[model samples]
Every structure is written in C-alpha cells, then in structure tokens.
Target: MNNFKPYYAVIFTSTQATDIKGYLVMAEKMENLAKQQKGYLGMDSARNEVGITISYWESLEAIKNWKANTAHLFAQQKGREQWYNWYNVRICKVEREYEFTLE
Candidate 1:
C-alpha cells in the first residue's frame, strides 16, 4: 500500500453464495479496475467462510466515483444477484495505523 496516511478505507465483508460461478473472475476484474481509478491507494482481502476486503482511497469522492463506475456497477448488480449471499460495506476515515513485524 502507498504511505497515503489519513486516507479513507472502504471495508467490504461478505459471505459468498452457494453458487459463486464467475465470482473470482469478476473480483479480479474489479481489483484491476480500481487500480486504474484516481486516489486508489491499495487493497487487501481474504476469504474462508466469510470474505473481507479493505480498499484504501484518498478521498470520499474517489470512493464514490469508484462505486458509480460502469463496470463496478455491473459487478455490484451481479454481486446482489449471484456472488454474495450477504454483504456489508463500511467507509471509514483512517487517521492512523501501525504494524508489527519480526526480524
């Protein structure tokens, strides 16, 4: 991720539907698309029983533009129709963060 501190984070949590047939393909596409957008800092994601994705952005306008993007809107429609059984999205202002590593 970029050192874009004081950024925004869009947290997406979901449980996949039983039939996730094009989910991975679409997810990859969306990630790639997000990278092309303005103010896209970075993203992190993981999944097992439930999936979580956190996308960092420079501003709320950037987040809003991404949400209203054509392909993303399609993906969102597909997510409601096919990909996710349940999902939640939270947007937050990340004032600060810290990490630990072993050397």
Candidate 2:
C-alpha cells in the first residue's frame, strides 16, 4: 500500500565502533525519548560490523527538532568523542512508499 506522503526519513550509517562505552544507554534513551516527540512515525535499526538507524518523521521540522534536542546533543557529542569511528546522516523526502504483508 502507498498512502504515506510528505514524510521524511533520516538515515544514520556508521562503521564498527571501538570506544562505545555508553552508546547503548544513550541510544536507548534517544529511542524512548523520540517516541514521545511529535510527528514521530516509526524507527528501525540494525547493526553488524556497521550500524544503521532509520527514523521516520511527519515533517522535516520535526526531524530537525529531534536532531537539535538536548539529549540528542549529548548523544552527538558522545558519538564524536567515543562511540562511532565514522558516521553520516542523510535526509530524504518520501515521494512514494510501498509495503507488503503476508498472513
């Protein structure tokens, strides 16, 4: 089905981290806190040697708000300081979307 429109997606990609001391704690806090923010659609994350986290937002502003949040700010500092070796964030507009389900 393709009903979603005007949505935004934030893709976070990172390589294996070496000094991720409090990464898990901070990540959990961010996830829980993000759900309480307005315009939150959903989020999905996966990792191996590399990690990726994709979060959906109703608008670009909401995503920006999240990015600038205080807790997120701390997380960002932590990432740069210890957690991630390298990372990149990409924002994209969802012009169309399709999903499938089986029962």
Candidate 3:
C-alpha cells in the first residue's frame, strides 16, 4: 500500500489462455520494468481462475508513459495474440483507502 494520498491505480483483470507458454516470464519482466519506471509506487497481484493485478502510480501521465513503453507494448500485443483469453484494464484515482490487520 502507498502512504501518499490521491494516487492512481491500474487494475488489470485477466483470464489466462490454456497455452501460457511465456506468460510467467513476461509477467515478471513487466513487473521489474514497471518498478524501474518513474512515478511507480507499488503493485499487488493474485492469480487463480482469474488474475488481478493492481499497480499504483503517482500520476495519470506516468500511467500513460507506462502504457506507451515499448516493452509493455510488445507484451500487450502478445497478450492479445496469445496469453490472455480475456482481460480488462481500469484506471482510477484513489482518494481514500483503509485496511485492517489481524494478529
């Protein structure tokens, strides 16, 4: 979670195709590349029948830059051609957030 207020979240929901050939490697690569990008805050992801990845950013412009990144573009093309059977991406401004911890 990010401490800063008014951050942006890119919520990526995906369902993997049966043939996941290079999915894991590409996913890891993208995550590492995203971490090296400007305005990148953090990311949390989970996978089961459906996969959900939420990545936090400092601004919408940063998100745009990430979307336009060459490597990411190639990954996106591959996702359309192979990896993902279905996917949806949503970008939102996070104004307020709260969480609880159990010990």
- Top candidate, metric lDDT: 3
When sorted by TM-score, best at the front, the candidate numbers are 1, 3, 2
Which residue ranges in model 1 land beyond 4 Å of their true spot? 1-4
lDDT against true structure, model 1: 0.96
**Candidate lDDT values, in order:** 0.96, 0.88, 0.97
- C-alpha lDDT of candidate 3 relative to the true structure: 0.97
**What TM value does model 3 have?**
0.94
Worst 10 residues of 1 by lDDT: 1-10
Measured by TM-score, how close is model 1 to the native structure? 0.94
The lowest-lDDT stretch of 10 consecutive residues in candidate 2 is 1-10
Per-model root-mean-square deviation over C-alphas: 2.6, 1.6, 2.4
Candidate with better TM-score, 2 vs 3:
3
lDDT of 2 by residue, 1-103 (tens): 5455678999999985677777788889999999999999999999888899999999989998998899889888988888888899999888887689998
Write down the TM-score of every candidate.
0.94, 0.91, 0.94
2 against 3, candidate with superior lDDT: 3
Query: Per-residue lDDT tens digits of candidate 3, residues 1-103?
Result: 5675799999999999999999999999999999999999999999999999999999999999999999999999999999999999999999988889998
> Model 2: runs farther than 4 Å from truth?
1-3
In model 3, which runs have C-alpha deviations exceeding 4 angstroms? 1-4
* Candidate 2 C-alpha RMSD relative to the actual structure: 1.6
